[model samples]
Target: MDEVLNFIIAAYPDDTLKELIQIKLSLDKTGTVQVSVSNAGPPVHLDRIPRFEPSAPTESNLDGLWYFLAKNFVDHLEFRNLGMDGWQAVLERRLSAASFEPRKADSEGSIDEEIAQFEVRPGRHDDAAELVDLTYDTYGYSYTGPDFYHPSNLSHHLASGEIVSIVATADGVIVGNTSISYPPETPCCAYLGALMVKRSYRRSKAIELMISETVAPAIGNRP
Candidate 1:
């Protein structure tokens, strides 16, 4: 399950933010497993899975590889179009009740231990400069969005609530950050982006904690 889900995030289209990817997993008494992944990217096509090497590997072509890997664990893969909302991919498999395997527990001092070292909180106006510095270190001025590079702009947005920022800190220094913004036309829905973690801190599960623990809860409290 982690293999398929991790590939889904890693292979997410460069044109879209990873924050937009949504995942759901379920298992039934009949020993059927199901996974649903939804995102605002190109439609999923089973034919896109790579059968052989190609001249160039675009994002769409690489998807073929993900689908191919999924085929090993799932009996069926279904793609559903959601109009302007994008698409969803559903994977399903069935097994004898006795064939189900329990998930392996994490070893001591693994991700949980690493995550305990940092703290997540809402970002302040003063954090703009540090956030910009972190972005520069990660994207090297190549991030497509120009707003984040300007500390003044980011500060203004943060102060005005145009952008809701979350930061993960260790020893009072920022190690990771993410933000949410609402589209003018779609105020009911928030777009999550600008997620970045210090190269040295990527293993701390800061990204997962920021989104699942902080961002989602903050969004729920929105008026």
Candidate 2:
């Protein structure tokens, strides 16, 4: 009985044990073993709450995103120094000064071979819907407000030629996207946004591929 309990406990990490557990074992005249096992804890439930209901995806953009994160970020921005005017000024200064530290492996990865199965498309369309979903999923609640626009809005910018957008799809799943918008009014440069990848697929080289193929070309760049 002890051996059997040990084996079962080793099998499931979610299983619980109490300091005191009752185990019963019996042997008939034939010398066969019978064992019983029980975990000492509240009943376990594996039901998943449906978070991605119709409410989540019914509209183009989820409105409460900034509100949700602001519950922590901006709400305490004054107390904790997040999103404050000074902080915003500091970040704006940093964003203005930040440069791409282009430490190449000396060579860029091949977009064709790396993202071969994935299609790199110009501008934005209905196809980018899933990439938007991937963005929310990857960054959770942070992909909103002044830092970036919603994925679909980014697509609109791409379609209008207001900005350049590129989305990467692998086997029909939108894994990542890259975008940069240049306004003629702002002559020196523009901003890059919507650069994201799914959490599980981040280990793969998908983001680089998308950047090289979609975003790089949109800005009249050559990799």
* Local accuracy of candidate 2 as per-residue lDDT tens digits, 53-140: 3345544334323323332332121111222221110100112233344444413442444444666666455544575576676676
On the 0 to 100 scale, the lDDT of residue 153 in model 1 is: 89
Best by TM-score: 1
Tens digit of lDDT per residue, candidate 1, span 1-223? 5645665566565754534878897887678888898877656565555652355666756746655566666798777898888777788888655356665543422444344578888888889999999999778888766778999988987887778788988889998888777556787887777678876666677887787755364453465
**To one decimal, what is the Cα RMSD in angstroms of model 1 from the true structure?**
16.2
Name model 1 segments beyond 4 Å from true: 1-116, 183-186, 220-223
Per-residue lDDT value at 35 in model 1: 84
Model 2, position 162: C-alpha lDDT score: 57
Model 1 worst lDDT window (10 residues): 105-114
Which pairs of residues have clashing backbones in candidate 1? Answer: 49-64
lDDT of each: 0.73, 0.49
